[model samples]
Each structure stands twice: as C-alpha cells, then as structure tokens.
Target: MSAADVWPIVKARLELLDDARKPLIETYIAEIEHRMKHYCNIRALPDNLLYVWASMTVDAVRVDLPNADEIADTVGGGANIKVGDTSVSGGSSGSGVTNTSKAVIDQVVLDYRVDLNRYRQMRWGG
Candidate 1:
C-alpha cells in the first residue's frame, strides 16, 4: 500500500489530531517499506500485513521522536542530580549505549519478527 493508504491508520494509532506530523510518519513508513522489501525479499508488502506495517511505523516514530533524547536522559535508569554544589549521576541500565550503525528498521524487524516470518520469502540458489 502507498503511504497515502497507510497514513490515516498510522495517524489514528498515534492519536494525532492534525497533519503536522504526517510527513514524518510518512517518512518512517517509507523507510519501513524499504527495509521490509530487503528483509522479506518481497517487491511489496502483502495487503494482509497493513496493521503490522502501521504498528512498525508507529514504533519507528516513537523511538526516534524529538523528545526521546530528553526522556532517555531522565528515565530507564539514567538520571542526574545536583544540589548545592554537589552533583551525582546514576549509572544507566545499558540504555545509554547507542549503536549508530543500527537502523531503526533493525529494531522494528526484531519487534515484529514473528509476523514477518509468517510471510518471509525463502531464497535459494546463488
């Protein structure tokens, strides 16, 4: 399905009230489609996988949202506090380690492995 077909569902899933983020969501959907093409060896995603596609897109948006960095700094075991010239920093629960080489699609693939596997095309011969 084209981004136009999937945009409304994604917007609803995200509870978005306006089109301000439409372009960003569409970008994520396109990236997911590209990665799905490579990962599943399919020219296009099957219609049955629309929900999966939208869900993955939503996840991609959430992971890369503008405020994600701010949230990461204070949540999930990463925190810093300063009081009266004294400062203390808490150790991160490994969430601070970022692998820049990994694309957001990689995580989405892991997240939806079960669904994708159901439709994965097997490749054979060199």
Candidate 2:
C-alpha cells in the first residue's frame, strides 16, 4: 500500500497505543519508510512526506502530535479520545466533563476511517 493510504490506519493505531509506548511507534515508521520502496515497491517519498504522514496518523487517531515532543507530547492532560466518541470542553482537566458538557458532547462522534487507495496512487503514481 502507498504510504498515504496507510497513514490513516497508522494514526488510529498509534492513538490507541499507550502513552508510554508511543515512542516505540516511531521505530515502526522508520522501517515502514524504508520498506515502502523495497518491500512494497512504492516510490520513495521525501522525508517531509514521512513526517506529514506521521503527523496525519496522530491526528486521525485523535491526539495532538505537536513537534515539541513527538510522541511524548501526544498524550496531553485532556481526556482520552475514544475512537467513536469525543468530547471537548474549556477545561481539559475535570471530572469527566460536567453533566451538561457530557450531554452536549454525547452527540459528538469521530469515526476512524482509512483510505488505502490514496496511498496507492501517491506511491505508484498511477
């Protein structure tokens, strides 16, 4: 699969990864980048693309991926974002959001999805 196509799923997986284990996720990426050309016959993307893909992955998984700390900064003080359910409030720190906020956010949902075809086109240029 093209790197672009795989980015969405990778982001989702990384989001689910434990906060402490996120660093290791970078390791997986280096190898994936290397193999995208050799193993998967994908065109080699510039390092910028790799970074962009990684960033996109983190976002898809519903987490902040600021360059300030890479994976370390990913897990912020805010409540964890569940795949299908997400809530936002002024205060990230609180008792699981106020009853009123909960009611409002209950209607908010983020469905995780990945499109591999996009990656294929970007990688194979077909």
Candidate 3:
C-alpha cells in the first residue's frame, strides 16, 4: 500500500489542522514511506499494520516539526541559555535536550521491524 492509502486514517487520527498543514502532512507521509522502504518492503506488509504505523508516524512527525525551532536552538546554545528566572542548561553532563517525539518514532521504527537481521528472522526461519 501507499501513503495515499494511509492518508485517510492518519487524518482521522489527527486533530483539526489547517489546509496549509495538509502539504506538511503529505510531506511527512512521503518521508514515512521512504524510510519504511529502506527497512523492508512496506508494500509487503499488511495494510492494517501499515495504517497503524502511518497514523503513528504522522502523529510523531506532527509533534516533532513544531519543536524544530526549539530543538535547533537547544542544540545550538540552549544549554548555556536561561529561560526567564529558571536556568534551562539542557542538563548536567551536557547531553542536550531529549526529543521525546523522535524517541517515540525510533521505537516505532523498531516495532515495524526494519532491521535486516530482525526482518529476516521475522520473515524467515530462525
């Protein structure tokens, strides 16, 4: 199946977004399809699972894109920067801020079983 087939379910899962956001969502869907292709043949997977993954990936992307500016700033100089009276120094050890949405997406990608070893084991015998 294609992202176009995944679009309706993705849209249904999301909150009301403006028409301007439509293109962004499309872009995200395209990205998902591209990324999934590298791991395994998405078209080979069940349509139901594809719908679930597409819906989830779109949500993750939706949450992540808005934080793009904040993420960039944090990577740039956020550790040294202070917010209002609170010091937002990224954290001790300078690991920088965590992108939770990205973490979720990464986990989801694993759930999709894109790894060569895992995918092969899943598709074939142990």
RMSD of each: 8.9, 11.4, 9.8
- Which is better, 1 or 3, measured by TM-score? 1
Which regions of candidate 3 fall more than 4 Å away from where they truly are?
A: 41-46, 66-107, 114-126
Tens digit per residue, CA lDDT, model 1, 1-126:
676778898878666777887776687888888777778888888898898888888666555552443323332243543222223343433332232213555776667888888888988877
Candidate 1: lDDT of 117?
Answer: 87
Off by over 4 Å in 2: 1-25, 31-41, 46-48, 56-73, 83-126
Model 2: worst 10 consecutive residues (lDDT sum): 104-113
Model 2: lDDT to the true structure: 0.39
Q: Give the Cα lDDT of each candidate.
A: 0.64, 0.39, 0.49
Q: Which window of 10 residues has the lowest lDDT sum in candidate 1?
A: 92-101
For candidate 3, the per-residue lDDT at 50 reads 66
Q: Write the per-residue lDDT of candidate 2 for residues 1-126, one digit (tens) a residue.
A: 355455445656444443463444444454445533443344665453554445434443233222223333345544355323433322233324223322222222112113222343434555
Choose the strongest candidate by lDDT: 1
* Quality of model 3 by C-alpha lDDT: 0.49
